[model samples]
Target: MDTPSYRERLNRVLRYIENHLDDSPDLEALSAVACFSPYHFHRIFSAMVGESVAAYVRRLRLERAAMQLSLSDVTITQVALAAGYDSLDAFSRAFRAQFKVLPSAYRRNDGPLEQARRYSIGQPLFYHLAPDVPPIDVQIRSFAPMWVATLRYTGPYDDCYPAWETLMAAMQTQGLLTVDTFACAVSHDNPDITPVDKCRMEVCLSLPPGMTANTLAVRNLLQDKRIYLRVIGSNSDYAVIEVNGPYSLLHPAYRSLYWQWLPQSGREPDDDPGFEVYYNSPQSTEPQDLRTGIFIPLLMG
Candidate 1:
């Protein structure tokens, strides 16, 4: 579900459903979120979101129920109905479907994540939900022809005020980047990622077609891969975090990079190659280096 803006849309719908759960958030109300027709919302959402809308909502509610069951002293019947199950039997049935055990059993026993682990669907071998991963450095390859919108600059790396000036001007001259589907920064000798003295950052510009004709922005993209301490956390406030390292300084972030970031982000690593996409490219050593995301293969430990 890390497909750029996928979560944005999904969250909108999920939130709508949650607030209106009692009202039975049918396809019509939810479909208006992304403006897609009801006929296609479910399938498209399920495919891109890694779980069905109904399934996601159900699991979320069930997870909430488990939490409430553990904390509240209410009877199982009360907890079941509170979680939106029609009856204790139905609640128990769905609970088992999610936790693989009955609510009574779970409450009687005392394992928080144990029962939830049984139903961790779409879980990668080692992915977890890490919110703020500490920073680290690793080796990364470089590339060219990458696309980006940028604010031009010519100044010392330590004081990048001039760069910001350009960005402010651009942001003012052109409308804000909300128009761009994605944001990126193209850095000429990016300093944060590299040890370069002088630098330039080309912010990824997002605008409608034909706007580029009169702008002082660059169109082509510079491609490069960066290895950094990557932390993946949920979008929530109390997000969990996974920090990864490459032992570049001989102290690997953890025994297993996969072991560390995977379970921490609470997400399984997907097959597609993941790269750090930067909206404001860190001052990389290479002029083309924007922020390079840490993309890794979630190999089994």
Candidate 2:
């Protein structure tokens, strides 16, 4: 499975430092909570938590200071010193920066809720989604490499089939492709910023071995990191219809295989090719249509 979000780790680290405030803490000590090396601790903490580790420590101390100021008869000077400030003036300066209120005002009516609320802000692959798609067996095999006359375009995925057809038409005269040929779409753009118009999809054919780039009349298929998954059963079957036709819209599919079958199958996606090859065949004589099996590259232990 992929790593969990950095934010989750940051939250845990924050909880640890906040809870251990009574003990005088050091950077090396706090970094242990995050599992980062001591050398880069400050940078990682700052990047994930949006503040220096020291600043986070300072704010938390003030947050507790605000609480202590309200609940007890402790004077402002004592609360400041207890919260790790050397003097009342220093504590006051830091407190007003974060809470927009001085120690004096906050002690009168301390609010922890408002400060913590700020941290709560907001912050796809093919074969990976199998298993809920039960009976799916996407294997990573050494695909005998082939050459393809290729076409590249960036558009909505629904718009891909047409672009593929254009490539087919352009290469048909050259006999580069034929009926029941395997068609592959290489994903080129990152999911972020490629949601619609910016998303890049490529239609390609495997080229013969020893062929140079110029041999492809159009352009050669660009090798890319991808996932391949095999879709089983005939297209009309409910399970086979997992990939929606153009009319429907859904997510890129959940990575249920990683969640379940991986431990069961003891397999993982291949790292180098980074693709799943789906295997399928035409069970009927339909123009430009046939069965498809998704093949994703995998590394099985």
Candidate 3:
């Protein structure tokens, strides 16, 4: 298969593993999901992902358990059980090894929970248990209301690119993508809190004055009153990241924004959903050269 097709298949496997962390399917099932023989699947998965499938699943489970421990009032045992551990002792050992703190201590104070690196559609999408933390520069600003043509995707954020492709095609057919066109992604749900299959995001483009098309739904993005931290080259209030590469790598940037930057920034999340603005066209630029501005909304005084 071609590279993009291959990455898509690999992403499917990753999504399945994440969505079913509580009881992920067996190796045989995963092989089938990847559409490869068990032996071939194992080798390819390790080479492309930099870890064994079992290892990846274990890490993801522990990571989810850590999120629950830090974010919710759930008991350690409950979090352990939900993370597919049969005994708290076993869970504690694994969690400590991965995060360097016991689950209970992590619950009381989340300062020590190591931030996990997110995966994407590139070759060798390795899991970095201890990736270096990058510095974030945030600019707060108020954005005017924008009229946009959007296509909404209600599933795993990783799976939203197809919706974007469709939206772009519809726009092209309707002659909407002109030189002045501006594109953005609107994410309505937090992936940590929302089920993977139920997350909502909109692929949007700025609508020319009085332009209308049946294929695209229109939305008014109004944040005139609140301030946003604009990063990634957008103009709005929220945590932002200027990411360059395939859209898949954007996940890690978001994880850093929420888990690392927000706590240090002293700002709180606003009521509006987070969104992204695209600065380069995917069709015209190399995947590695694509620049996207990710805008996260925050409450401001």
Candidate 4:
């Protein structure tokens, strides 16, 4: 199948899976969603996505269950049922197999509840925030609502190039990208907590105002009044350093900011999801010379 057509069909099925996680979608139903024959869909999905459809669904369920455990005060039994497990024992076994951490322990120690409350309060305060180090620059800027054309990719970060290529081609065909065009990647899951195979990422290009997308998967990102305590430094905000390197090195930079910088900075993360704005294209720029700016949305004290 062609790239755009394949991405459209596969993205549709993936979105369907996300929207209906509690409901088990059989191979025939998934194949119908992908518009491929049942046998053909199974082989093609595994080959292209690097995991079988059943495995993919189960992983998503378990990972989401983990997220709920860490982020919410929901009971283990309720979480298990929401994850489509019949019993807490089965969910516990599956969670342990995947994460090697028990559900209860995960909730008490490393969950969002623990991280935010503990890190901000007593003992864990000394862990990463270093006031001796220079402050990180963060800009609080407002932006007009952006109309974007997007393609969702549901696999490893490295596997996202195909989706970008597909989206770019569609943009070029529709005459969307121009001198003022902005490009960004929207990350939907935290890699530390979510499995790489199940991570959701989108390659997006800003579209002209009032432009209508021909594809079903296109979405609008409205940020009219959205406020961000951005980590990309300026004279008024905190200090930010530019890192020109492979994308894999980004995690360390994030660690430095959150652990090494955030505590001393007196800022907390906002609800808005952080994203990367690409200043240079990977297709033309070498990995070593790539220029990408990482922005973490935050709340200033």
lDDT scores of the candidates, listed in order:
0.46, 0.49, 0.64, 0.65
lDDT of 3 by residue, 92-128 (tens): 9998988777887666655322323123223212234
lDDT of 4 at 118: 62
Off by over 4 Å in 4: 1-4, 110-120, 123-146, 154-174, 214-301
Please name the candidate that would achieve the greatest lDDT relative to the true structure. Answer: 4
Per-prediction TM-score = 0.38, 0.37, 0.50, 0.63
Each prediction's RMSD to truth:
16.7, 18.6, 12.7, 8.4
Cand. 2 TM to true fold: 0.37
User: Where's the lowest-lDDT run of ten residues in candidate 1?
Assistant: 221-230
Separate clash counts for every candidate: 43, 39, 6, 6
Q: Write the per-residue lDDT of candidate 4 for residues 145-185, one digit (tens) a residue.
A: 46566666666877799877776666665565577777877
The better-scoring model by TM-score among 1 and 3 is 3
What TM-score does candidate 3 reach? 0.50
Better of 1 and 3 by lDDT: 3
Write one digit per residue (lDDT tens) for candidate 1, span 80-112: 887788899999999887678888888776333
Superposed by TM-score, candidate 1 places the C-alpha of residue 141 at a distance from the truth, in angstroms, of: 46
